[model samples]
Target: MRRMTPARRILLLVAACVFLACTAVPAWRGAKIAYHLHTARYLLGQGELAQALSWLAYPLQEQPRSAEVHYLLGNTYRRQGNFDRALRHLAKARQYGWRREEVDLQVVLIDVQRGDVEAADPLLDRAAVHAVPDDVAVEVYEALAKGYLALHRIEDAMVVLDTWIQWQPRAVQPRLWRARIHERENDWDRAAAEYRQILSVKPDDVPALLGMAGALLARNEPVQALPYFRRCTELAPDPTQAQLGLAQCLRRLGRGAEAGQLIARLLRGSLTLEQQATAHYELGLLALADHRLHAAIRHLQTAVDLAPQHIALRDALAEALEKAGKSRQAASHRQQAERLRQQEDRISRLLAALAESPHNPDLRCDAGDALMQGGYPREAVRWYMNALKIDPEHRRAHESLARYYEAIDMPDLAAEHRQHATQAGAQPQLSKPDQPDGLRGDGPPPTPKACGPVQDQPPLQKLEQRAGPP
Candidate 1:
C-alpha cells in the first residue's frame, strides 16, 4: 500500500464528495427513516411510548405507503396495550407487503382478547403454518384454545390443543386441558392417558392428580380411585377437600362408619360457599344410603340453601325430600330451578340488536369479522368496505380490508389500504405527525371494487411509492 500524494488524495476526496452529492436525495430519504427508527427505539427503551410517536410521524406523513412506518406505529401501540390501534397499524404493515406472519399473530391476539375468537382462527392458522418464533406460536394456539373453550366450542378447542401439544410437548397447561376435555367427553381411557403423561413429567402436579382420581371414580373403579384421592389429600394445602374425596370413596366401598367420620369433619372445616354445599350434599347422600331419613332430609336442605342456584343441588334435595315423604317440598325446589333457567340470555339480546342493525358500521364490521372467521373472504371484504363507506377512518374495517386484499393475492392494494389504516387510527398527535389537511387529502378517490367504497382513495401514481405516507 503506497502512500498517495497530497494532490491525488485531494482529487479522490472531491470525487467521493461529488458521488455522495449525486445520491443525496435517496441518502437523505433513507436517513430520514433511519432517524425515525433509531429515535423511536430509544424512546421505547426509555418507556416513553408517547414520546416515540413524533419520530415515526414525520416518516409516516412522508411515506404513508411505507410498510416500515406502519409497522413501527403498530408495535408502538402494541406496547401501549392499545390493541385497536395496534391492529390497525399492523394491518397496514401487512398490506405494505411485509411480515404477514408477525402481523397476523398480533391480530389473532387482539381478536382473542376482544372475545372474537371467531375472527382470530384463520389468522392463527396462517400464523401456525408460518415460521414465527416459538413463543408467539404458543401464545397464538393457547389463546385460541382458551377462547374456544370459553365459547363452548369444544371440538375446536381440542383441535388447537392437539396442535399445541405437538408443538409444545413440554407445556403442562395444554396437556392438562386436553385431559380435562377428554374427561368431559367421557373418553375415560384417553383422559387417564393424558393425565398420566402430565404426571409422568410433573409427578406432584395437584390438578392432574385430582383429575386422574376423579376420572377413575367416573369409571366406577373406586378401588383404583381410593389411593389417588388419598394422595391428593396428602398433597393438598387445604386437606379439607381431601377429606371429602376420602369420604366419597369410603362410602362407595361400603365402609359407612369411616366415611361418615370424614364427612362430619369436612362440615366443620373452613370452606367456600360451594364447598359447604358440597360437603352437606355428600353427607346427605351417605345418610340416605344408611336409611337415616331425617338426617338425609336435614343435610340435603342445608346443601340446597347454600347453593340455591345449583340445579343438581336442588334436584338432590328434591329427591331426598321425596324419599322422606315430602313430595310438596320436592316440587317447590324443582320449580325454583326452573325459574332460574327461564331468565333471559343477555348475549342473545345483544346479538339480536346487532343482527337488526345490519347497516351500522360497527355492526357491519362485526359481521365482516364473523364472515371472515367463517371462511367467506369476499363477503367479509364487502362488509368491511361497506363499513368504511359509513366511516372511512374506522380502523378495524381498514385493517380487515388489508387482510382480505392480501389473502386474495393483491399485495399492492393490501399495502395501500394497510398504510391508509395507520393514518386512520386514533393515535395521539405528536409534533405534527402529518401534513396539513390540504396535503393529506391530496389523493383522489379510487374506483369502488369488490373491497367496497374506497376509504382513502389510491394515491396518484407518483405518490403511491413516495417517500412519505401516501
Candidate 2:
C-alpha cells in the first residue's frame, strides 16, 4: 500500500464525523419519543385518554418512521372509539414496514363494529397466525371476542373465548363470556356450569352469581338458585334484579312469606315497568295459591295491564279472569296479549339503551312515556323521577311528570311539577289572546299551566316568572 495524501486523510476524517453526527440525531430523537410514549402509556392505563392523545401526538409528529409510535397511536385511538383516526394510524403503521398482529387485530375490531365482516376476516386470519406477547394477546383476543359478540357472530365469539380460556383457564372474563354465550343459546345446563367455574375462581363475581341463578331458574332448580340470587342481591349496587330473582325462587320453593317480604321491598323502590309487573305477577301467584280470588285478580290485572307482552302472566291472568266467571274479559285480555307481543322487542331495546346511558334524561323520559302508555302509572312516575335526578331542569321530563301526577290524582303534586316545568323553561301554551307571537312587550308573561296530555286545570297565575329567556 502506498502512503495516503494529507488532503484525502482529512476528507476521510470529515466524512466519518458527518456520519456519526447523522446517526446521533436519530438516537437523541428516539430517546425523546420513548419518554413521551412512556407517559402516554401510563395515562392510557389510567383512562386519561385525552391526555394520552396529547402526549402521543408528540411522538407521532417527531418520529413518524417509528413503528411502535404509530402502533401506540392506533391503539389509543381505537380504545377511544375513534375508529377512523385509528384506522388511519394503523394503516400508516402497516405501510411503514410490516404487519403488527395486535394492530391488525384492533383494526379488525373497528371493522367488526362497522359491520364490515368481509374486511375484518382477512385481518383476523393474519392475526391468528402471528405470535404476540401474552399480555398483548389477551387484550387482542378480548377485543376480537367482544367485537364478534356485538355483531351476533356467536360461533366466532365462542371460538375466541374458548381459545382464551384454554390458555388461561382461571381467567374470569372469558369464563363469564362463555357463560353468556351459553345463556344466549338457552343451553341452561352448560351456562350454569360455566358460571360455577367462574364462581370457583372469583367467588364474589356478581355477574356470575346472577348468571348462575338465572340458569338454575331456567332449568327449574329454584332451590339451587336461591343462595346465588340472595348473594347477588347483597353484592350488587342495584339489587332489584337479584332481589326479584330471589323472590321468584322463594315463591317456587313454597316460601311465600319470605318471597312476599322481598316483593314488598321491591315495590317501595324505583322499579322499571317490567320489574313492577314481575313483582305484581309473583304476588298474584301467591294470592292465587292461598285461594284469595279477588286479591289475585287485582294483582294479576295490574301485572297484565303493565306488561301484557308477558304471555305467562297473561295466561295466569286469563285463567284468573275465567275462574272469576268472566270469559269475555279473559278473551279480551288474551287478544291484548297477542297484540302486545311485538312491542316487547322495542321496549327491551329502549330499556337496554337506558341501562347503558342511564344519565340521559331524554331517554329516561321516553322510557317513562312507554311505561305510562303500557299502564304502569307508578312505574312511569319512578322513571320520571330518575330523569329528574339526572337533569333537574329537564323541560320534557317535568312536563311529563306533571301530567303523570295529574293522572294519578295528585293535583297538588301536579301543580308543583308545573311550577318546575315553568322554571325549567317550558313555554306556556301560546296565549289564547295571541297578541302577535312570542314574548310580548306586554306587561307580564302568561301564567304557566301543566303541559302534556292532561285535562285542563287551573293555571298557576299567582307564581312569579323567574325563567329569563326563551
Candidate 3:
C-alpha cells in the first residue's frame, strides 16, 4: 500500500471518529440499557421491588419501546399489587413484540383477580397447557384460589384447590393450603383428613404433624393429638409452637402439671408476640383448673395485655375477675369483649357485602378499613387493592394503601400511592412508541362491568379438558 499524505491521514482520522460515533456510541448506550434491565430482573427475583423499579427507571426512560423492559416492569408492578399499571405495561410489552402467550396469561391472571373467571377459563384450557410453563400454571391456579378466597367464595376456592391437587397430587403447598381452609371453616375432621394425607406421603413433615395435632386438639381429642405433637416437637425447625401444642394437649388430657412445666419452659424461650400470648393463656387456663385463682388472674391478665383483641383471652379474664369478686373490672372486660365481637361481626358483614357486590369500590374500601380495625392488615391489603381495581383513583383506597406501605417501610410505594391520591384526573402515562396504543393514563377509568359472560361449561369442567375428572 502507498504511504498516505499528512492531510489525507488527518481526513481518514476524522472519518474514523464519525464512524465510531455512528455505530459504537449507540451500541454502548444500548449495552448500558440492557445491563439495567438485567439488574432490574435480578433485584425483582431478590424481592427488592423498590430497587428493581429504580434500576428499571433508566432503561424505561432510554428504551421506551423495548419489549423486555416493559415486560419486567409489568411483572414488578404485578407483584406490588398495582394491577392497573401492570396491565398497561404488559399491554405495551405485547404491542412491542414480547411473547404473546406469556402476556396473555398475565392478563388472564389479572382478570381472575377482578373476579372475571370466564375471561380466565378460555386461557386455562389443557390444549394451551404446553404453552405455559409448569411454574406459570401453578401461579394461575394459585391466583384463582386466592382470588376466590379473598372474595369469600370458599366453595370456589375448594374447587380450585381440589383441581390443583388432582393435577399435582404430590404438591405439599396445595394440600397445606387446603388444610388451612378447612381449619378456617372449623371443619376439624376434614382438616385432619388433609393433614393425614400429607403425613402419609411426607411422614416427617413438621407442619403436617403440627397441623394434624392441632386439628385433633380442636376436636378435643388430645389423646389422639399427643403423639403428633410429640413427633412435631422432635422434627420442627422451631419446636416452640409444637411444644406449646403438646402442652395444650397435655392440659386437655388432665395432665395439668406436665402442661404447666412445658409452658414454663416455653415462656423462657424467645417467641413472637402472638406465641407469647398463647403461652400465657394456656398457663392461665391450667392455673384456673388447679384453683390457683391469683396465679390464673395474673397469667390471663398478661395474656390479655399482650393480645387485647383475642376474644377468648378477654372472656377468660372476665370470668377469672368475676370469680375473684372484682365485678367492676370483670364487667369492663366483658364490655371490651363485646366490642371486639362487634368489630369482627362488622368485618364479616362487609366481606359478605363485597361478595354480593364485588365491583363496589366503596364496599371494598369499607371492608379494608373494617379488617384493619379488626387487626388483619394483611388481608385488608387485598380489599384495598380490589377497590383500586374498580376505581383506580379512589381516594380512600389510595390513602389507605399509602399508609399501609409507609407502615411497612416501603417509602417508594407509599409515595407513589400518595401521588396517585393527589392526582385528581390523571394517571402516569407512558409515551407512545411506534406501535398501536397501549393503556392511556389520561383516559377514563375502566367501566365497572360485571365479570365477563359466563362460560357454558361448568367452572370445574372448564379446567378439566384433557386432564382426567377432577
Candidate 4:
C-alpha cells in the first residue's frame, strides 16, 4: 500500500483510538463496581458503617436494579440500627429478584423494631405459608417468634418456639429460653426440667446451673440446690450472685456461722452498689438466723440505705427499728411501704378496668398482673392461659404463666412457659427483687458503712439509691 496523506493518517489514528476507548470504558465500569462492592464490605467489617454506606451509594447509582447491592446496603443499615432505611433497601432488594426467607426474616425484624407488629405479622404468616428453604424457614419462624415476644404475646412466641424446636431439636437456645420463661412464670418444676435439659446438652452452663439451684431452693429444697449453687460458683470464679446464693443455701442448711464468715469476707472488699447492697442484705439474714439481733439490724439498715428502692429491705429495716424501740424510724419506713403499695394498687386497678373489655389480649395480661399482686398466682395463671387460648401467640400470657408456674414450685411447667416466653422474644430478666428473710433483728450496729471501694473488688459501701439501683 502507498503512504497515506497527513489528513487521512490523522483520521485512521482517531478511529483506532475510538475503538480502544470503547473497549476500555466497559471494563473500567465493571472494575469500578467491583471495587466499590468490596470496599463497602471491608468498611462494614471494620465497623465503619457510615463509610460503607457512602461506598455503596456509587454502585447503587450505577446498578440501581442490582439485588445483591441493595441486600448489602440493607444489611449495613440494619447493623447501624437504622431499621427504617434498612427495611426500605431490603424491600427494594426483594422487589429486584431477591425473594428469600432470609430477606423476609430481616423485614420482620425491621418491622418489629419499628413497633409495627401488625405489619410484621402478615409477612411472617406469608413466609411460613410459602414453605421457603429449611434454614430460611427456621430463621423466619425464629424471627416471628421474637417479634411476638417483643409485643409481649407470649403464647404466640411459644408456638413459634415449639415450631423451631420441632424443626431443629438439637438446638439449645430454644430450650434455654423456654426455661427462662418458666422461671419468669414461677413454674419452678418446669423451669428445672428445661434447665436439666440444657445441662444434659452442655453440662457446664453456669446460667442453667444457677437457674436450677434457684428453682430447687424455691421448692423448699435448699439442700438439693446447694450443690448446683456451689457448681455455679466454681464455674463463675468470681460471681457475686453465685456467692450470695451459696451463702443463702448454707444458712438454710443451718450453717449460719460459715455463711456469716463468707458475708464478712464479701463486705470487706470493694463492690458495685448492687453487690454491696446484696452483701449487706445477706449478712443481715445470716445474723438474724443466728439470733444476733443487733448485728442483723446493722447489716439490714446498711442494705436499706444502699438500695432505698428495695421494698423488702426497707420493710425489714422497719421491722428491726420497731424491735429496737426506734418507733419514729419504723413509722417512716412503714409509711413509705404503704405509699408504694398504694401506687401499685392504683396501677393494678387501672389495668383491671382495661381488662374488663374482652377484646384486648394485652389488657388480659395486665389483669393477670393485678391478680398476682393480689396474691392469687394460681388465678393469674388461669387468666394468662385464657389469654393464650385466645391468641396462641400472646407474649404476656406466656410470661405470666411461666411466673405462675415458678411461684407454684412446678419447674417443668415453668420451663414450658419460659420456653414460650423466649420464643415470644421476651428479654432476659436483669434483676430479681430481694425477697424476705425468715428471721428478725433487734438493734443497730456501731460501724458506719464504708464508701468508694476499688472498682474491681467486692462492695463495702452502703449508699442509698433508687429502685433497680444497679
Residue 302 C-alpha lDDT in model 2: 94
- Local accuracy of candidate 1 as per-residue lDDT tens digits, 313-423: 777777888888899988999887665444223223433444334224666677677656544577667667766654667778889888888988999999988987898
* Candidate no. 3 TM-score: 0.63
**Each prediction's whole-model lDDT (CA):** 0.69, 0.72, 0.77, 0.68
Please provide, for model 3 over 148-188, each residue's C-alpha lDDT reduced to its tens digit, 9 standing for 90 to 100. Answer: 77666565666777776876687676798899988876899
Query: Predictions ranked by TM-score, top down?
Result: 3, 4, 2, 1
Residue-wise C-alpha lDDT for candidate 2, range 159-237, written one tens digit per residue = 6666667556887778887888777657898998999898898898788899999999999999889899989989986
* lDDT (10s digit) by residue, model 4, range 141-177: 4445545554344554565556556545755666777
The collision pairs in model 2 are none
What is the lDDT, from 0 to 100, of the residue 169 in candidate 1? 74
Which 10 consecutive positions of candidate 4 have the poorest summed lDDT?
444-453
Q: What is the lDDT of residue 359 in candidate 3?
A: 54
**How do all models score by TM-score?**
0.48, 0.50, 0.63, 0.52
lDDT score at residue 40, model 2, on the 0-100 scale: 89
Predicted structure with the largest TM-score when compared to the true one: 3
In candidate 4 the C-alpha lDDT for residue 460 amounts to 24
Residue 318's lDDT within candidate 2 is 81
Task: Please report how far candidate 4 places residue 41 from its true position, in Å.
Answer: 17
Backbone N/Cα/C clashes per model: 12, 0, 0, 50
